[model samples]
Target: MPAEKKAYPLRISATVLEAMQRWSDDELRSVNAQIEYVLREALRKSGRLKAGMAKPMVDDKPDT
Candidate 1:
């Protein structure tokens, strides 16, 4: 079974939120998803996450 994601309430300045929102739109990801992606990238760069640990599970869904 895959590990479940935990939710946390985050507080950030409006300016940062606005910037993140724009980046998220550009990346075609929800703001929450983009934030996770950024954090994951940083962790990988810092060597906190191993290559295997950084790989998110791919869900196979049929095209409509």
Candidate 2:
């Protein structure tokens, strides 16, 4: 089964939001999905999220 999602309110600067909107548009993902993808990647890089804990949007190979 997939993990349940939780909703949380976010307050962001207009400039940052605009950038995110543009990036999300280019990536063909919703703003929410873009934010989640970034956060997930950061967590994984920092060793907070295990590779097996969450399914990646793409095949992520470790740095050589």
Candidate 3:
């Protein structure tokens, strides 16, 4: 099953919001998507996300 998402309120300065908006536009992603992507990357870099976590296989053939 796909993971569920939770919504939370955020408070930030207009300067930060504007910067994020510009970055999100450049990345071709919604502001929320960019935020999530950035947070996930930060977590991974900080070792908060396990490196050995499961990853899907690339093969497309049906199981025999």
TM-score of predicted structure 2: 0.82
Q: How does each model score on TM-score?
A: 0.82, 0.82, 0.75
**Overall lDDT per candidate, in order of appearance:** 0.79, 0.79, 0.67
Runs with alpha carbons beyond 4 Å of true place in candidate 3:
52-64
The candidate 2 region of ten consecutive residues with least summed lDDT is 55-64
**Selected candidate, larger lDDT, 1 vs 3:** 1
The weakest ten consecutive residues by lDDT in model 3 span: 53-62
Please write out the lDDT profile of model 2 over residues 1-64, one tens digit for every residue: 6576788999999999999999887777778888888889899899999998656554323344
Supply candidate 2's per-residue lDDT for 5.
76
- What tens-digit string does per-residue lDDT give for candidate 3 at 1-64? 6455678999989998899889987877667776776777777789887765322222222355
Task: Estimate the lDDT of model 3.
Answer: 0.67
* Candidate 3 local Cα displacement, residue 27, angstroms: 0.6
